[model samples]
Structures are given as structure tokens and as C-alpha cells.
Target: MNYFITGGTGFIGTHLTSLLHKVHPKAKVYNLDIVKPGTPLPAVKDYKPALREGKEHAATFIYCDVRQPIELEKVNITPDDVIFNFAAVHRTPGHPDSEYFETNIRGAENVCAFAERHGIKKIVFTSSIAPYGAAEELKEETTLPMPNTPYGISKLVAEKIHQNWQASAEDRQLTILRPGVVFGKGENGNFTRLYWSIRGHRFMYPGRKDTIKACIYVKELVRFMLYRLEHHDSGVELYNCCYEPAYTIEQIVEAMKRVTGMNVNVPYMPGWLIMSAAGALGALGSPMGICPARVRKLQISTNICGKKLAASGYHFCYTFEEALADWYKDNNNQCLE
Candidate 1:
């Protein structure tokens, strides 16, 4: 078996690649992305590689942008290969509005086209909870998407493209996982930023204490993706990948303190004031690491459900607390300011 991945250098992609190497040791894995996973992760003690069919696998990283089908054209794709598409312009504060579409939407098109041309019918794509937008009500799989940003809209569009591609062929098996704020070791995004904030004694509640954030551990998400790929019963499937009973920011803060021993009695900062400040910063090109719009986003709840996946009988290995503990255990020495 051969595995092909787009955006293998990314945080989630990096973990996915490592886990795949352990589970399918002999299967040749090709990572088609513009960059490598960079510095090798310190090997975990007692790491167990997946031993299936008495074979092991290896992974090879290749520089290829998903926007150009020609870049994928040269790869020796075959019928037994599975494509995992994780490439997207997801950094909320860094990229332009157009960059999101050019990469996310167009990249989906190129990937779908390549798959159709090569009869590579199996695909697992990672989308985001951003598509559901900031809903006051809990969002389930049936929720009508109301994407607010270019990134969210592009992901919603990409989901449709994958759906259409699946509809065009009877043999296609597509799985679209709309994940929330994925966190774990090597996740240098929201969770890690929070770590530094707590360590620096700078963490403050942004308005309310009950602002819910949906999240998944990187390894747990990858494990589920691989499980679905191997034991899939065919047909298209969509699942929101996140912790159930989504934790509040306050809960996350407490978890950080418990896991990392970071002490911070973060005070509440009003939303309006933060928004106004963020707006001013946005106007000044957002010099501050925390943008005003993002400050506003922090106040909103990203409530989402993984009921569909849950009902499918796949048990998640990590809850919010367990996932936090896992990260702290892995990065025990790196939790400081």
C-alpha cells in the first residue's frame, strides 16, 4: 500500500506522517508539499511502529504545490495508493483574502482532477470548523454552513468540490473531516500561544469565562483518519473532529495550570474594549501578535459536535483533559515562557 499526502510539512501533517510510518512500515509514503516537515521530532521513548500484515513502511517528502496539477502529474500514482489532502492557507492573521481561495479552493480542484485522472478513488481531506462560522447554537453535521472569513468560505467550497468529485464516480470513497482547533506537541498555534501566555503571567480572560472552544489532539485526529481509511465501508463520510463537551477557555486555562504547573489568575478583559483595541491594531496593520479581530474571535464560542463520528462506533482516545495531559507529558520541559 502507498500513501500520498499534500501539506505533509504542516503540524498535523507531520504527526500524521510519523504515525503512518509506525503503522505501515513497508508502505512507501509520499508527501507532496512545498516544504519538508523540517527538524526531526525527538523520538518518543517506547515508540511502537504499526505492524500490519508483517510489513513496515517509510515516507518520502517531495516538494510540490497542490495549486498546480502538473506538480502532482509527475508522481507515480497507482490504484492502490490513498491520497490525504491537508494543504491549505490556514494562518488567520498572516495571509491575504485571495491567498486563501487560491490555495484552498484551487488546490482542492487540482487534487480532485489528479485523483479522477489516475483512478485514485480513495481520499481523506481535512477541512475546518471555521466553515460553520461562529454560531451561538451548537453546530452539528447538519448545521447550515455560515462561513464568515475567506479561509472558512474557501474550506466550505473545497468540501463541495470533494463532494462533487465523489458524486462523479461510483468507486470514489471520500471522507471530509472538519476539525476544530487541533492541539498537541508541535502545535505552535492557539494552544501553544496560550501556554506562553500563562507562563509569562499574561493570560487574561477575554470577556467571558464560558467561551467554548472545540479542539482535537493532533495524534488522535491522525489516528482516526488512518483508522477510517483502512476499515472504511465505502461511500462518502463527513465528521466534525473535536472533543465532545467542548471545554471553556477557563477550563483550558485551568488545565494548563494543572498540567504545566503555571500559575496565572488571569483577570477578565471586556470584549468591547478588546475589540476596539484590536480594531485600532488592525488599522495599523496588526503589529501586535494578537489582532483586534482575533481578540473579538476569542470572545466567541466555537461549539461543534462530532455525533456522526461518535455514532459510527469509533472511540476517541483523548478527551480535552487527556489530550492536554498528553501534550504536557511530551513537552514537559518546553512549557515555560
Candidate 2:
């Protein structure tokens, strides 16, 4: 079997591509990404083994943006190949509103179009929990998606596009994983931002103490996604890819301290103070990258659950605690003093 992965150099994509290399050694692999080999996109560079292995094993890196299918038109894909679509402008503050829709929604349309054109029958898409939007209520697969943000709306649209693509064919299979904050080794965004702050001895807490963070380890999420793809029948199979009992702020802090063995001071600053400081820093060019938006997200609980994934008859290799330990071993933050 052949495999085609968009954003193959990304956190989840790189890990998934590596697992594929180990399992399907003889199969052809195509990494469709804008950033090619030798250029260590900061996030991809953190996973050193992936940087080396992806270059060696993948049949080719088709240099192109998902927005431009003309560039992908040159690749030798076939009907038997399975496409794993992960391309998206996910960093909330990094891009403008239109850029998100242009890249995410348009990218989704292009990928499905490319697959349909090539007669590809299987696609595993990584959607986001943002689609369900922020709510105090526990969001499951059945929860009506009322995405408020540009990112959330785009992801929800992408899911619909995938569903429509599958509906067009009787034999096509579509597996959509609406994952929460996925983090492991080499992750960026919230988890990595916190890890870096803690590692540098600059970690702090907000006034809110019990905010629940819905998250998944990258490895486990990928494993579950692959399992669903293989086991589920032709048609749309959607799963909210995260743990049922999500971690609280206290739990995450305790785990981080235990894994890193660091005694970083954790002081509780009022949300107003933290947000004010972040806003002031942003106005002053944010040398420390103090993000006010991140501060807001940290304060709220987007309590999500994966009831469907848990009932899918697959065993998880690592729990949140084990996941922390595993990454801590490889990270440069473990402490002795």
C-alpha cells in the first residue's frame, strides 16, 4: 500500500509517518508539504529522528501548498493509496482570519478533490475540538458543532467536505478524528509553551484552579486513528479523539513537576493581572511571547470527552501520566537539583 500525508513534517504527521515506516517498510510514502527536507521547520527539528528518517524513507516530498493542487498534480498517486490529511493553519494567533479559511477550508476541498480524481478510497482526517467550540458542557461526537472562531469554523467545514466526499462514493471510507490539544515530544502551542515556561523556571498559574484541559498523546491518537481506519467499514466514522477524564490544571502542574523534577515557583496571579500583563507585553512587541489569547484559553474549561474512542475495543499504550514520563525522558528539562 502507498501512503500520502499532507503536512508530513508536523508534530502528529511526523510521528504517524515514522510509525508507517516501521510497519509498512516496503510501501511507498509521499510527504506533501511546503517545507522540504534540510529545512528544519522549528517544530519538526525538535523530533530529530523524524527529520532524519522522513528524508530517508518517504518516496518523495512533493513540494506544494494544499491551496495549490496544480503543484500536487505532478505526484504519482493511485487509487490504492491512503491519504492522511493534516495540513492546516492551526496556530490561532499566527495568521489572519481569511488565511485560516483560505488554507484550511480550501485545503480540505483540494485534498478531497485530489483523492477523488485519483480514485483514492480511504482518507483519515485530523479535525479539531475547536469545531465544537468552547463550552462548559462535555462535548461528544453527537454535540452539534457551533464553531465560533475562524479556525473552528474552517475545521467544521472541512469535516463536512470529507463527509460529502465519502457520500459521493459507495465504497469510499472516511475516518475523521476530532482531537483535542494533542501533545507529546516536539509539540508546540499550549503544552509546549507551558513546558518551555516551566523548564525555564518561569511557570505560573492563574486564579482559575480547576480548568479542565482535554488532551491526547500524539502517539495514542495516531494509533487509535489508524485502528479506526482499518476496522471501520466504508462510510463516515467520526470519533472525538481524547480521554474521558480530562486533566485539571492542578493535575497537569503536578505531573509536569514530577516528570521534570523541577521546583519552579507556581504562583497564582489573578486572570485580570495575567491578561493585563500579556496585553502590555503584546503592545511592547511581546519579547517573551506572552500571549493574551493563550491566557484566556488557559482560564476556561473546554471539557471534552471521547466516549466513542474508548468503546472502540482498542487498548491505549499510554495514559496521560505515562505520556508525561515518556516525553520527559527525551526532553532537555529533567532536573536533578
Candidate 3:
């Protein structure tokens, strides 16, 4: 089997690619990213060497921009390949919203077009739980997408691109996975930000601590992706790829306290105070450049329902507490000290 992945250098992509290589030793694994495999980043030193170790020895690295048309002459994307579209401008503040549309939306369309034209058998897309927006209750796949931000809008648009392509093709199989905030090592998303805040001893309750955020560990997410690929009989399925039990913000912080043994100095800062402070900071544009937009995003609830996915016969490997403990165990000295 041959597999091609966009954004293969990303946190989830790297994990999934390495696992796939290990599972299928002889399979050709191609990684497509903006930077060459051996390129260095500030956060992770010798990232390329780390990515190339063990399972990825036989992996092929291709540096290309997916937004533009594929240069078949340079790197041939064949019909026999299984494509996984994991490339996107993921959560980061202050990034221009247009970048999300160009990359997430246009880039996804390009992938779908390439897959359909080249007769790729299967394409797995990584969608986000962001599309569900801030729901009052737990959200399901059947829930209407009411994306508030440009990032969420772009992801939903990208999902539609795959859906349209699947409708056009007769033999093609497409699986869309809407996973919650994925947490693990090397991931610096919302969950990581929270972990860092706690580790730095700056943990504070954001208004109410009852805001529930559905989460999935990297390992379980990869398992679900592999399972969906093997069980393609479902015919273009959309699964909420998340852990069975959700964790409230307070519960997660408490778990962090247990793992790190850090002094929890949570202050009950009023919501209005936070909003005002954020607004003032936005106006002043301090050295750290805190903004009200970011503050609003931080406060939004992202709870989701994973019953649909559970009913599909997928089981979660790590419980919420186990995942939290593993994260602390791995990064305790650095983050929890």
C-alpha cells in the first residue's frame, strides 16, 4: 500500500505517518510539506532527524505547496495512492483569515481535484470540531454547522469540497473526521496553551469552570483514522472522532494540579473585568499583544457529542485522566516544574 499525506510534518500528521510506516513496513509513505524534511524549527530542534528516525527510514519527503496545481513532472501523484489531507493553517491568533480560506478551502479543493482526476481510491480529510461553534448543549454530527470564525467557516467549506467530489466520483471513498481539540506532545493548540498556563503557575478560572471541552488524544485519533480506512463499507462516513467522556475546564485543571503538584492560584476574575482588560490591551497593543478577539475565543465552549462515533464501533484507547497524566509525565520537568 502507498500513502500520501499533506502537512506530514505537523503534530498529528507526524504521529500518524510514523504509525502507518510501522504498521506497514514495506508501504511507501510520502510526506508533503512546505518545508523540506530536514529543515529546523525554533520550538523543536533537529525536527527533521526526529521525524526521520526508525519507522520513517523508508519514507519519501516531498516539499511542495498544495495551493497551486500539482507539478506532475516534478513529483508524480499516481492513482494508486491513498491520500490524507491534513494540511491547514490550524489555530493561531493574529493570522490573516484569508490565509485560512486560501489554504484550508482552496488547498482542500485542489486535493479533492487531484484525487478525483488521478483516481485515488480513498481520501481522508481532517475536519475540526470548530464548525459546531459554541453550542448550549453537546453537539453531534447531525447538528447544523454554525461556524462563527473564519477558520471554522473555511474548514466547513473544505469538507463540502470533499463531499462534492465524492458525489461526482463513483468508486472513490472519502472519510471526514471532525475531531475535538487534539492533545499530545509537540501540539501547541488550546489544550497546550492551557497546560502551559497552568505550568507557569498563572492558572485562573476563565469566568465559569463548567465549560466542557471534548478532547481526543493523538493515538486514539490515529487508530480511528486507520479503522475508517479499513472499514470503507460505511460509504463516505462523517465521524466525530473524540474521546468517550468529555472534561470540564475545572476538572482538567484539577487533574493538572494532581499531576504537577502545582499550587493552584485560581482567581475569580469577573467576565466583565476580563473583557475590559482584553479590550484595553487590544487598544494599547502591549508587548505581548493580547487582544480581545483572542480572549473571546478562549472563553467559548467547545463541548461535543461523540456518541455517533462510539456507535460506529470505535473505541477510545486513552481516558481523559490517562491522557492528561501521560502529557504531564512526558513534559513534567519542562512544563510542570
Candidate 4:
């Protein structure tokens, strides 16, 4: 059976492609994304060709945007083909609020519609814990989504759009995974920034050390996704994809230090000072992930629960420290390059 991955050129998508190659060596995988294979995104410049070396030649690249009606009439898609929906504008404080809904929500609708037309039985959707809100509460699969940001709201709506498609057919299978902050080699997000900050001795606690950030290694997340896709139960199944006990800011920092052998003392910086510095930088701070919105995010805890994923019988391949170490090694002993 062939595999189709939307947003397949992205950080998580690229890692997923690599992992799929390891598992299914001769798999006919198609990467459908707006970004071409050779062109790496500016933010994720470290995304190297070596990551998809052997698999790159095998997988087909399709230039398709999910926001519009997916025009894949020429491509051969069968009922057994699996579709992974990873398309979305996920970055916070990066795009206009309307951009989130325009891309994420419309993308989901179009993807589900395409699935219906092709009679694709299996679909894997990568959602976010942002739907559960950014509060310090422990979010579970059953938690009522109270999305505060446009991205979260769009994701939530997108989840329902996929769910509606699933409900239309009894035999169709849907696996929705709401992942936390996923970090690994190609991730240019929070963890990468943290690594750089610590290595450069510019790391400082935003306000408190106890702020919990639900996170998972990219490889581990991909493994779980594959496991579910291979041995999925009938009908719709949802899970919060994160470590069982999420790590606090202090714990995460300590893990990074142990893995990278960098133990510069990190002092807690006052919230007011950070805001003042951000204000002084004007437009400069936004691009550096230091704006007011991102600063506020640093203070809030994304305490998402992962009991369902844990109970799925999929063992975590890497611990927090081990994951960090592997990421460091993968990036040639650098901050994931």
C-alpha cells in the first residue's frame, strides 16, 4: 500500500518520512506539501538532505496545497492507501490571526473531502494540545477544548471536520493525535531555542522554574503514529501524544544540561524586564520568539496528559535525556544544527 503525507516537507513531516523509510523500505510514499523537497524552510535551515537520503529517491513529491481543492486526479489513490494530515499553520505570534483559520480549517475540510472522493479508509491527523487551552491544567482526550488562540481554534475545528468525515462511513478509520511540543533534530521550536540559549549562557527562567511543558521526541511521536496506523481499532480513536509525566522547565533544563554537558547556572529573569527588553527591541523581538505573546506563553504551563497514549502499549523509545543526547548526536554534536 502507498502512503500519502500532507505537510510532509515540514520538520515533523520530514522526520516521519525518515522513520517510514526505516520501517517500510520499499514503501511508495508520496509527500504532498507546498514546500518542494530540495527547498528547506528558512526557520528550519538545519533540515538536511541526509535525514531523507535513501528514502528521498523513493518517495514522490507532489506540489499540493490543502487550502484549495486537492487536485490529484492524475495520481493513483486506492482504498488501501493511507493519508496522513499534517498540514497546518502552527506557529504562534508568527502569522496574522486569519491566516491560521484560512490554512488549517480550510485545509482539513479539503483533505477530508479528498479522502471521501478516493474512498481512503485510513487517515492519521496530527493535531495539537493547544485545543485544550494553554492553562496549567492537565488536559486529557476527554477534556472540552477551550482554545484561546486562533491556531488552537482552527485545529479544534479541523479535528471536527475530520471527525465528520469519519462519521460518514462506518468502516473508515481515523486516528487523531494531539501532540505536545515535539522536539528533535530538525525541530526549530522551543527546545532548539532553549539549547542555543543554554549553550550561549543566555538562558534564564522566564519567571518560575516549575512551569510544565508537555513534550515528546519527534522519533517517539512518529513511532506511535506508525503503531496506531498499523494496528488501529475500528472507528475513531483520539490520544494526547506526550510524555506520561510532563517535565517542568527546571527539569527540562537539567536534562538538556546533562545531555549536552552544559551546566551554566540559569537565573530567573523578571517578567517585567523581559517585556521591557522586548518593547525596546520593537519589531526585532517578534522574529526571535521574544514578543509579548511568546513571553506570556513561557510563563503558562501546557500540562497535557498522555495516559491514553501510554496505555496504547507503545513503549517510549527514548527518555528525555536520551532523546536530547540522540538529537545532539544527530546534529553532529551541535544544537540540532
lDDT of each: 0.79, 0.80, 0.75, 0.84
The weakest ten consecutive residues by lDDT in model 2 span 44-53
How well does candidate 4 score on lDDT at residue 11?
79
RMSD of 2: 3.1
Cα shift from native, residue 193, model 4 (Å): 0.7
The local distance difference test score of model 2 is 0.80
For residues 79-148, write the lDDT of model 1, one tens digit per residue: 7789899999887856789999999999999999988888888999999998998776899999999999
TM-score of 1: 0.89
**lDDT digits (tens) for residues 1-337 of candidate 4:** 7889999877778888877888898778898988876565675434453234443533578999999998785677889889999999988877889999999999999999989988998999999988888788788899999999999999999999999999999999999999888998667688888888888777688878999999999999999999998788569999998898988989999888887888689888888897777666557735444567777888999999888888998989888888889998987886554
Question: Using alpha carbons, what is the TM-score of model 4?
Answer: 0.94
lDDT of 2 by residue, 104-183 (tens): 99999999998888899999999999998877888888999999899999999999999999999999999998888887
**Model 3's lDDT to the true fold?**
0.75
The best candidate by TM-score is 4
Tell me the deviation in Å of residue 337 in model 1. 10
lDDT winner: 4
Return the TM-score for each candidate structure: 0.89, 0.91, 0.88, 0.94
Q: List the residue pairs that clash in candidate 1.
A: 22-50, 23-50, 24-57, 25-56, 25-57, 26-56, 26-57, 27-57, 278-292
Tell me the spans in candidate 4 whose CA falls farther than 4 Å from its real position.
42-58, 283-287
